[model samples]
Target: MCLLLLAGRADAAPIGYSITGGSVDIDVKLDGVVIGTSAGVALTGDSIMMDTAALTLNALRIEIAPTLISLSTHFGGFDEISVESAIIEGDITFANLWSQDTGTPGLFSVGAGPLLVTGSWGATDSTGINAGTSGQPITFPVPTITGIIDASPGLRIDSVTMHSIEGTPFGEAGKHLTIVASYSIETEVSIVPEPGTGLLVAMGLTALAWHRRSGSGAGPAPRG
Candidate 1:
């Protein structure tokens, strides 16, 4: 029989974090099985945490940060700027709190994760840099940024990656641009029992114990 075993407490307290930028996509796992996924919301960089104290789960992942992806640009000498790409070049750092020793800060690492980029572009003669009458963007398809990433075992990670997309508009040899965009992250979190369910269970058990003890200690029903 295949016996899956783990050696950590799934009921550990939540780890606090503050996202400086970008939204995140979160999923949770228990014993290698996915329990559920939650959509990420934009944060104002406030210190917060994902609660995991009542869970028996053992796995967490940063599945995909699609919402967190962003774009920045730097352009000069051009009168018009077209953001043909969301991310031209960038860097991101991730941290896995599950792998660190208790009471100490966790270690961080870099991963070459999924990204988004441009698939095509128009040239200087295709026209539309300076003489283009209307300011309608020449649309380009977004391409998938796929690749493998590296990380340590026994860790729950939350990460943010930042990228800068730079480009020079066609025919406008004098315009410049400096753009910055942050990419979304995909991550997995630990799952626990339904919210408030664990607490109710604990309370029920305690009440039951008190009732049993009280009955056992009471004398036989008062003589009628």
Candidate 2:
């Protein structure tokens, strides 16, 4: 016989978020993996949010890429700019409140790589010089995940990353800046069986076994 326990109360989960910025491009990595990127998107806003489904998640690693764009006029002789950034957020559910502390129920990390800048510029009559800058690498601190759990409740997380880039006019030396930002959120759930259900199943199996044993004994006595 097989016995099944009742479902236990759902425990609240923990959610967290992290943000980072760069001069030209931004890369958002979750749990040491890249999930998303944005180029020339603009960073005027303090934060941005992305759909969790857009990210690649299988057990742990997340992969992402940046969006691109083009410009009509060149600033400081630069024809175009590319910006990128990374952001991550999400929640983890627990079977029960005690389990959350006893076991590592929810935890996550965020990080950023060096900024990459690439563009072209032309010389003007006044300065007689046109120059462009290529992409460069940069690094930033990793983000940490933290949150509190609730009784039989779900957890929510929100995070955003921002980036910006600038180009200068050849002769005038005036610069134009481009910015981009992105964000995302994730949610996880856990389930457990209740004590009462387990006990009920155990009793049911025991009763069936006893009844079978008594019936077999009666048949043997009749045969004798």
Which candidate ranks first by TM-score, i.e. highest? 2
Off by over 4 Å in 2: 1-10, 15-63, 84-132, 138-161, 166-176, 182-224
Q: Residues 70-97, candidate 2: write the lDDT tens digits.
A: 4344444544444332322222321111
Question: What is the overall TM-score of model 2 with all chains considered together?
Answer: 0.29
Pick out the ten consecutive residues of candidate 2 with the lowest summed lDDT: 6-15
Q: For each candidate in the order shown, give its overall lDDT on alpha carbons.
A: 0.30, 0.31
What TM-score does candidate 1 reach? 0.27
Q: Please, what is the TM-score per model?
A: 0.27, 0.29
lDDT of 1 by residue, 7-105 (tens): 133245443333344453433222223233335543223222333332111221222222211212212222232322222221122222232223323
- Tell me model 2's lDDT, rounded to 2 decimals: 0.31
